[model samples]
Target: MIKDLFLSGKTAIVTGGGGGIGRAIALGLSHAGANVLVNDLGVSVSGDSEARNPADTVVEEIEAQGGRASANHGSVAEAKATEKMVEQALDTFGSIDIVINNAGIIRMGEFPQMSRSDWEAVLRVNLQGSFYLSRAAAPHFRAQAGGAYLHLTSASGLIGSTSQANYAASKLGIVGLSRAIALDLGQHGVRSNCLAPSSTSRMTELTDNARKHLMSPEKYEALKRMRAASAPERIVPLIAYLVSDRARGINGQVFGARGNEIYLYGQHRPVRMMHAAEGWTPAQADERLPAGLGAFATPLEVITDVFTWPPA
Candidate 1:
């Protein structure tokens, strides 16, 4: 099923396709019979400007395998650059059917110690970039009556994070964005979904701050095991599948992939309900709410706490 060519005749724009999971998804999508536009700024995971643009290398690899592909060296942080990406895809492939928001950067800081610039920088690329790409393609998608968006979010966004406040905020913001897009555009046959993937990539590398302050010995060891067991390739197939025609019925949901395991994230809903028939004052409200509802409150869990065992 993973090797099915269900995406034949589609065109996909894969941002951050230079390396890691982004590269893997681009290659996989192309092999599924889609024309791919591999876009990468060639900057490090930190989002610094660099001399090289690695998009071309991935394009070369796709071409070597007898696939149709092109390269774009634009930064997703800029709206105009993302617009140009859509233009390039349309010019080369005739139409854009899929947009993969895989380009993101992480800056480490605890809540109190986080700098404003660091927070804004991460959101600019990770959250706003997703907006730019999706917005740029939306008109075309509307005109064509169909399209798909696959945003690569993270467990840090869904669950609690370990001193990655900026990164977590951006990733969680993406979930909200995806839900909005799915609701606003689903009538037009457009679909939007989020993939919270675990992988051994540059973003997953443990930071020194986390090493020193954020973790106990147990958590530190657990994180190391997670990074070692999850590979970027294992997360790619689900991403590719989410943006293909085969997944047309699925929309507005968050899914996860780690190792060979895939699972759905529970969306928010009320777990308990309490009614005060007498319309109690503030004093009585406190007495009834906590005693009745506190027991049902969800525990604060990190990715590791929920996934106690290593994935196969």
Candidate 2:
């Protein structure tokens, strides 16, 4: 049997807690003794609001399990709504000790074909939404002298994916935002970390080909072999740890969590720097370009080399 981390008096607000990995984490946190605020817009994958019962359903599940929880329906993309959601948590629970910024949306289209509106729409929800929530919660965390901030990122942020420039950009933006917040909030006792989770959620459900690529045939077979396996629940333990007192010293780090597999993401590797010294002219550059490019030659090589191609 697992020992309880003992969070009987703590309160948590999990944005996007209505379903998928967010719901799993909220359930785990509530099971550990925290009263939770479940905030979700019930938005579709494309950022359109659809279901109204998802957040309510999560709350009901928590209550049925004898865990305290309240539901809030608001788009994290809007600053006013985000603030109101945080306020609702404080009003209902009296204090906010943990926040999981899991609210996000995806707009996928190939570059040169993707509309500016689509790009902005993805950023509005995935990146700006997290910022708005964090901004609202920072003061509360500071006053309490401690809190946990968990942002949901993706493997696409750490690597490249085809036709997902906007999605990748937004996700990568969260990593930088989390790092900055960690640096600024550490002195105030606030811990900020990000999770790049590989779950078979609605987000993944939309892209079947992408799902196949993410899970190798062997890995998929192994997953099928396990009884009662759900990728959503598998990521919860790491989240629980990050929010627990045991992870007090861990901040500004990115973790990759999948079914029964947790790994640290984003360790800076050595880079080969090239410089055009000795007054190298354009002609010289072109002449020696093949050898200069070395193993990094070709457009496909460029695409495969960097996590975000043609960096913005």
Candidate 3:
């Protein structure tokens, strides 16, 4: 049996804690003894409007289970509001020890058809919100001598997806941001990591393909036959470990997490150098296509097949 990884006196602030994977993580943290501050604007999956009660409901659930918790309904997109949200945790729980930056939204459209508003909205919440919260929490963590950040990214961030350019860009940006923070905060005893999670959530429900796969018995059974499958709870163990003292030495890492499988994401491949003449013209560039493209192509047999898990 696994031992209890209790936080006891620790305090945590979980953004987007009202629902989906965020709520799951928050509840898990509370179960482990942390006094949690659940921050959720409680917006719809498209982030169209607010639902403040969602945040309240999560807080009620936590308290009902004998866990100490408070609810905050605020937009992480607002820097001042985000800072204030973090302050609520400090004020209520005394100090902030963990931050789970799990709030995000998705607005899908083909690249040419996607509206500017959709693109900006997605970036504002998914990328800038994480930045605002991290900036607000860094100082407190520094003063306290330690803390942890777990950003909820997506497998789509690691691999490309159709009609999700904005979402993919934002999620990838998170990985980059976390890496930079991990480097800067390591000396201050703060750690930052990203989790590319595959879990059933309201966000995933927006996609017809995902919903069909999740709700249809045949598809669900097919998923079970796959080598790797993951539930939201499977991600909790990693998040719990990262926030604990056990992960002090593990920094600047990204994880691919799903039901029962956790894989480490390593260094990215850099663009390779190619030989070219000093005076290579546009025509020459076109002529060298076969050679230039050779290095980037996948095997012919696999080109038509879809990959369940693409390379990170």
Most lDDT-accurate candidate: 1
Task: Identify the candidate with maximal TM-score.
Answer: 1
Write down the worst ten-residue block by lDDT for model 1. Answer: 206-215
Task: Count residue pairs with overlapping backbones in model 3.
Answer: 3
The regions of model 1 sitting more than 4 angstroms off are 1-3, 207-209, 216-218, 278-280
lDDT of 1 by residue, 119-166 (tens): 999999999999999999999999999999999998887997677888
Inter-residue clash pairs, candidate 2: none
Q: Write the per-residue lDDT of candidate 3 for residues 52-147, one digit (tens) a residue.
A: 558889899999988899999889999998999888998898889998999998998879999999999999999999999999999988988899
Looking at model 2, which ten-residue stretch has the lowest summed lDDT? 303-312
Q: Give the TM-score of each candidate.
A: 0.94, 0.84, 0.86
lDDT of every model, 2 decimals: 0.88, 0.81, 0.81
**lDDT comparing candidate 3 with the true structure:** 0.81
Q: Show the lowest summed lDDT stretch of 10 residues, model 3.
A: 302-311
Best-to-worst order by lDDT is: 1, 3, 2
**Cα misplacement distance, residue 182 of candidate 3 (Å):** 1.1
